[model samples]
Target chain A: MRGVVLHAAGDVRVEERDDPRIELPTDAIIWVAAACVCGSDLWPYRGINEVTDPTPMGHEYVGVVEEVGADVRTVAPGDFVVGSFMASDGTCEICQAGYQSRCAHVEPVGRSGTQAEHARIPWADGTLVVTPGMPDADLIPSLLAASDVLGTGWFAAVAAQAGPGKTVAVVGDGAVGLLGILAARELGAERIIAMSRHEPRQALAREFGATDVVVERGDEGVERIKELTGGYGAHGVIEAVGTQEAMQQAIRSTRPGGHVGFVGVSHDVSLTGQELFYATVSLLGGPAPVRHYLPDLIDRIWSRKINPGKVFDLTLPLSDAAEGYAAMDERRAIKTLLTV
Target chain B: MRGVVLHAAGDVRVEERDDPRIELPTDAIIWVAAACVCGSDLWPYRGINEVTDPTPMGHEYVGVVEEVGADVRTVAPGDFVVGSFMASDGTCEICQAGYQSRCAHVEPVGRSGTQAEHARIPWADGTLVVTPGMPDADLIPSLLAASDVLGTGWFAAVAAQAGPGKTVAVVGDGAVGLLGILAARELGAERIIAMSRHEPRQALAREFGATDVVVERGDEGVERIKELTGGYGAHGVIEAVGTQEAMQQAIRSTRPGGHVGFVGVSHDVSLTGQELFYATVSLLGGPAPVRHYLPDLIDRIWSRKINPGKVFDLTLPLSDAAEGYAAMDERRAIKTLLTV
Candidate 1:
């Protein structure tokens, strides 16, 4: 089997590796159908996050179950499924409370690596949501998205309380933010504002139902959102970029009593308590409880209600994952899909 | 008329002043029956908040309406009223959404010197909530508490989502935090934890329905709370102390998906976005739209359902307003009520 590994910063290699096998009774083995490079993966690829030794890559995947351990019950061999980046036992109090990412028995599958020919999915019954019947070949990318990005965007929109009568402003033109615009629209937001300077991403944002697109970044971007919402700011703001500027922009763009659902992976972002307190916006976001939204996201994709996979601007064979990484790093592609 | 004034940091003076008169068409003049020193007042008195010019102090008040402008409709002369610290027109979209503190026509009546023989209240109709009738003298303190501290604490509890089966933790030992304990209990929280090292405040907390009292502060306080909640942390946390340590403690105490309602006036407090994001606690708070809660709070106070005035440990005539400030600043009094 071949798997993606980061031997050092800027060094992504698709090398031979031992195939995954169920090591726990609660685990299931799945033959990877599709996966993609995540923004967080860029942390190490860009050398911002230290990579001391070779590390497996990819935490997003949708595949066909090849085998299941004795305890696996919800999924079976030959079943098509999408799993969350974080695996949980599903029965824990935290999982029952709908925050599977914080489950007591949580396993971050990102460390195990999903970008491989075969991967072991721990707590399969809880982490993986099986798709209805066999998905169409074209729907695989969307379903794969449901595993992480799309589901995450959906969670961010939900956390932001984007619904009827809400003017939702999205910060970030990355794949997650683009999908967030689509999710907010599907969630019944009256207006969706996507912040983007890139023409291609802005075009995609508009296609995904962004009622308004602001090309400005940072403080100016907030002003644009406020101007669009009659100087009161949007009722909901989705933050998909983790930078301090983006976080502050999201907070400032939301009206008082509004919600800011931030899914961006925070890095070097220090929020002034006084500013957040004075903003009076309810802030809720983190590693989104993606598993909780996977079933619904997969349903939407399967029903062709939303095409979140459209975020993928480039597609490559699994072996050429390096090019996919470089393309996204250089801002040449919004996201890249690696076919397994 | 007489009023409390700060000539400089720590230089409080009880000085004669001109009687307040309605100036704006939406204004009302109130003959203050009772007022109190607040935790925030200590900021300037203790030299933490700058006081370059002589500043009239106090924002919490319940008094007899002396006069109303021609346009005032909801409140009139001869009515006994309790108003929020921040006067809002209440009809604005933000007020309609229940965030009166951020109302477009907001006038912080605090600057008008509520702790005086007479004070002018702006947007009288929206800022003042009249009691059923003039209350007995004994209820003045409680009614005064409802004007700000009680209302702010109630908003904090509501923001924290304290209710049945929830473990609500309060992170202030001041009048507001103690009132928050009572508010959480009123909101049906099964367990309330008060973080206070002060024996007097802890005793008051237990009386106000705090089921647990942790004397630890900062990280140790968080550890105590986590241990109390079986390592998962409280379901709700009310931050009533606006400092970096208190804010961090509040965030750390709350479980994922939990709510932290922080009403403490943020002073030099900065929140790390990474810590906030990973903690996954929903942060909701500000000056606490006290006007929104005044009616309900006043009713509870008037009916003797809750004695929020117990927060007032010292009582003094309006002439001793300077001593009142000194007492709270010297930590000799939890709260000081000034009688006019």
Candidate 2:
């Protein structure tokens, strides 16, 4: 099987690797139909995260099961499925509480490299959510989005309590942030503000139901949100950027007692307890429990009620995965989907 | 008028100050019936927070309105009232959203000290919640507690989402932590775990309805909570101490999808962003919007439903406000009430 691997910092290579097989009783081997490079993957690719050895890359994917473990009950061979980025037993107390990312028996999907032609997934019976059938070729990207980013944005919107009669502000221009704007609108937010200085992203935000676009930078950006919110700040803020500035902006742009759903993978940032305490904003985020929303998101996508797959503007063959990573890393593409 | 003043760190004095008069059309001069030293006050008194000028000492109080400016409508002369430490216009969106502490026109109760014979409360009509009548003499301390501590504790419990079927763990053994135990019980928490090493505080915690006690120190304390909760952690955690260790303990003691309500005035603590990202806990805190809960807390106190005033172990005449501050600073008293 061919898969992408990080030999070291800034060194992502697609090379032939040994095929993966069911190693655990609850595992299933899936023929990767689609996979993509995630924003978090850029952490090591950009040398911000230290990589000591060659490591498997990619976690997001939608595929057909090639084989299932003996104990697998829900999914069988040839079934189309979408699994969360993080694998969970789905029976643990944490998973039962709808936080599968924090499941005690959790495993990262990248352990078997979803970027490969075929991948082995743990906790097959619990982790994989099967679609009604093999989705039409045109619906592939949308169903694939449900595997991670769409579900993540939806979770963020829910965590931030974005809903009817509430004003929501999104603080990132990434695919997830764009989808967050869509999620907020779908969740019935009265007003949606997308803070993006970039033109392309801003246009997509508008297309995704952002009622207003603010191009201001930093504290001035927060001031703009306050002005838009009648000086009380947005009722909900979605922080999809992990920088300290983005976190502070999210906190400062939200009204006291409002919620901030920050799905960013916080990189090299720390919060001073005093300022956050003084802000009096509620903080809720983490690697989202994508599995929690997978079923509903798949249904929504399959029925053509929402099109989150628009996030992937560029698609490449699995062999060209490196180009996909470059385009996204350089901000030339919102996201890139690789066809297997 | 006489008031307590912090001349500098470790120096408290009772000195005659100019009498407070109505400063705004919305102001009301209250003849304080009872006032107390708060745990937050100890921060500057102990030099953890730098004290420069002679800062007037108290914020919590229950009193009778002696005079009111022309625009003060809800509160009038001769009315007994319980007001929050923060004076808010109460008409702002934030206030309407139940976060009065962050009201657009918020005024902190300061300088015209509640420890004095008279204190000028700004935005009187909105800040003060008048009781049905003059409170019973025995309820003065409880009424004063509701003005800040009890209300704050209740807000913490409410923010943590404590209710039936949830396990609540309280960190910090101060008066607020003890009151948080009471608040959790009132909120119908099925199991209350009080983390306290002090015998006196533990006793008070048990009296306040803590179903279990964990005396284990620091990290071990979190372990104990997890062990007790079947390794999933408590459903809610109240962080009453603002230190980094206590904050981390509260986060670690809560389940992955649980909430942490922290009311501790943060000192020099900082949270590494990556760590909190992994914890996946929802955090809500700050100077609690006490005014939002003041009305209900006062009613409960007036009806003798809760005895939060027991937190005040020492009482002194208003003229001896210096001793009240000194007792609290010296840790000789849990809280000190100054009677005018």
Task: Enumerate the candidates' DockQ scores in order.
Answer: 0.81, 0.89
Model 1 chain A worst lDDT window (10 residues): A293-302
What does candidate 1's lDDT look like per residue over A13-110, in tens digits?
Answer: 99998888889999999999999999889999999999999999999998999999999999999999899999999997678889998787889998
lDDT of 1 at A4: 97
Per-model fnat list: 0.76, 0.91
- Quote model 1's TM-score: 0.98
Candidate 2: residue B53 Cα off by (Å): 1.6
Error of 2 at A232 (Å): 1.6
The true-versus-predicted C-alpha distance at residue A260 of model 1, in Å, is: 0.6
TM-score of chain B of each: 0.98, 0.98
Off by over 4 Å in 2: none
Candidates' lDDT values, in order? 0.91, 0.90
Residues A154-247 of candidate 2 have per-residue lDDT tens digits of 9889988999999999999998999999999999999999999999899999999999999986899999999999898999999998999999
lDDT (Cα, tens digit) per residue for candidate 2, span B1-340: 7888888887878888889998899999998888888888888888888997888888988888999999888888899988999999988888898999888899898656687778999999879999998777899988889888898899889988999999999999888998999999999999999999888888989999999999996889999999999998999999998998999899889999999999988987799878788989999999889999987887788788889999988998877766776787777788888887
lDDT of 1 at B232: 87
